[model samples]
Target: MIRLPENTTVFDDGEAVARAAAGHLRTLCEDAPNQRFAVCLSGGSTPKRLYTLLARPDYATLPWSRLHWFFGDDRAVPWDDPLSNVRMVREAFGTPSPIPETHLHPIPTADGPEAGARRYEATLKAFYGAETLDPARPLFDLVLLGLGEDGHIASLFPGKAALDETRAWAAAVPEAGMTPFVPRVTLTYPVLASARSVLFLVSGAGKQDPLARLSQGEDLPVGRIGGSPLWFVDRAAAGA
Candidate 1:
């Protein structure tokens, strides 16, 4: 419920953001050296730099073999489409992504939206079936998210029914309001709030207005995620 530039790390540029991300990854893996990192990755230009950095050899120092990667949200596009978050991650990572297939959880975009969402749910259940962990917690130790210009996080756009969804930690987005109308796959509010930590990676001049509105509790999707979330922003994005 509080926003403080001093609380979260602020990077001046994309390079700095990448370094911070790599450093965070290193620290997280250090604590659980033998355990897999159940991380949820964000998609967007803001995180593209981090993705490339992580896929590199230096960033690959982590026990990639034991890393588990999951997407926080995905567009309802075919697997090969440029908009596919899965493909973007696969492409960003060089030869060895350090993550094994058993750990990579990409949405089933190929089968179409409805089926894709259903299949992804099964995937999640299969992974944490007996853990007794709620749909949101522990799915990811750290969830990296990006704030949309409209204050939307993941596929939970402003005023969309998805924001009101309470059934599962993850849900299928079938509202045709979104331009593409492709089924979007995303983690629900409970799951988001359940995460051990949530980091909002926001860096862009176009985001100032929305960020201002969110700060005022304008009832945006991004505003709903109010558990003292950590934010990463550039000077320009902050309009400071």
Candidate 2:
């Protein structure tokens, strides 16, 4: 497990988080060749700021067409529902909208959570194309995530079946203790560990305790990553 430094830059408010994502995305875009710069995103309030920041001119200059968006997880709710991650991302992409729906690879949540996860996993395989996502040799370019107050990332909540999943990279597991939505789609740790780069967006005082615990090597889902997780923390969330 890798440990985060005590004095990482604090995005003053959410601005810091936004700038961090923008810069990293611009760099990633520049690095990839003609192929798509595939990025799997977390569904949470944390990334909303980053997505909004990308709408600006500086961030907007990325090769949007050569980019593909995938979700780290999603509620079983309909796309139009308030609990929809798809809605959040599309809404965040206002104005010129960086990419079209053709580029957005949302998991099929409309097909009920369980079925949606299955369909989405198939889509993921297609996205990887020739590279193929193998649990033994995972190699995602970038996997962006958000820190849940309860230490969850993606749909891999504490004690969620997916947490113990060592087989499938993407799967649907029973959702209990979860709010209203039923089963959800998620990317397992084995797949996450294979990523070349992992970026986390954390904000709010509500997240500080988890951040502290995570930094102390707590066995939280987001902390047990096989690869490094570069956290973009905000001032209030980092604690004094």
Candidate 3:
């Protein structure tokens, strides 16, 4: 059987999970010594709650100005498209927030999936100041992730070509495994691995099967992620 990480936390529901994640993020930002922090954001209902919570007045003390936001992946669609992760994040974070325009780094989709992936990779390398990722100096201070029903993470579907990527920091997913079916631009495992902390936020009763399979050591996309992630799941998703 696969061993669960020691930091796994189960809450009563999705809302509770989001609240706990927000608290953890607040602490992470507050205790960080870095003059500037980089955060990789995930796209999902539960994560939207966390983003909304962070934008509220209660988290006003969070160092938003110094914190740079990056997307783990985005659909190859217009930024304003209803299915776009960028749109979801923008709506969740709300306007008139402390996050500066430059701090929010979105995956560019106008040039199509392949071009977008290349551009995003260059953007990350520029921010990291290196073409190669160094384990000693991680690229992101925190990476927030979500578990898909199909056991995917950051558009990295099981058995997809993106999973085999070792050199490129980003890749183009021509066809997604599930709904929306749009091509995607996603950060590869090598890039995601260079994170100080990774957290998986999983909820919904539909997620129980995947979580159970993971517990049984069934190989899946999310399992391949590099960092030792802390799973924050709801009771339903935890099968509790």
Candidate 4:
């Protein structure tokens, strides 16, 4: 088996992982030098719990006004669809959240995955105020990611052409490797790497094989992520 990175953290279960992630997010926001903070969020059942935890009173009082939210990836579905990542996030936050409506940027899926990818790329560039990414500047303060059972991160499935994307900020996946099998729009590896930190939230026994592959140094899609990534996993997923 591949060795677990030094940055890996194992929890008793999914709930503990979520609590820790919520606390870390607050700290990152609090520590940012600039008033504005950009965070890229991942979509999955694991991260859903973290989002819900953040909505709690203890974590909800963070500087929501200064925080700008972006999605790392999104399925090509209407925002109101049951499978929509934006809808999941909105539901997790519940009503009357302090986070401003303008701060929450969701990938537009009404126009199809290819068009949606282009639109989201434009949105990221506009927010970053430049057509090209500057590694020194870093596009996001923190990017929260989730690892799929198939070893995919965000929507960058293994063997997908999107994994080869080196310059584009975003790209469209015409087909997904797993069920739901819907098209998707995702930030490219370059864009994901331009972050101060990338946190992978992994849970459930289903993730064990992927985690093992990662530990064995297999060049999976998740491994393509540049910079150091901290993986927060539960005992079951970690095989601890």
TM for every model, in the order presented, reads: 0.89, 0.89, 0.96, 0.97
Clashing residue pairs for model 1: 64-98, 136-191
**When superposed on Cα atoms, how far off is each prediction in RMSD?**
2.7, 3.0, 1.6, 1.2
The residue-by-residue lDDT of candidate 1 on 12-74, one tens digit each, is: 865676678667777877887677567788888878888888877786577778777888779
Worst 10 residues of 2 by lDDT: 1-10
**lDDT of each candidate versus the true structure:** 0.74, 0.74, 0.90, 0.89
Q: Is candidate 1 or candidate 2 better by TM-score?
A: 1
lDDT of 4 by residue, 97-121 (tens): 6679999999999999999999999
Candidate 3 on 1-240: residue-level lDDT in tens? 224446788899999999999998888887885568999999999999999988899988888889999999999999999999999999998988668999999999999999999999999999999989888999998899999999999999988999899999999999998998999998999888788889999888888878878878889988888557889988888777
* Model with the higher TM-score, candidate 2 or 4: 4
Q: How close is candidate 3 to the true structure, as a TM-score?
A: 0.96
- Candidate 2 matches the true fold with a TM-score of 0.89
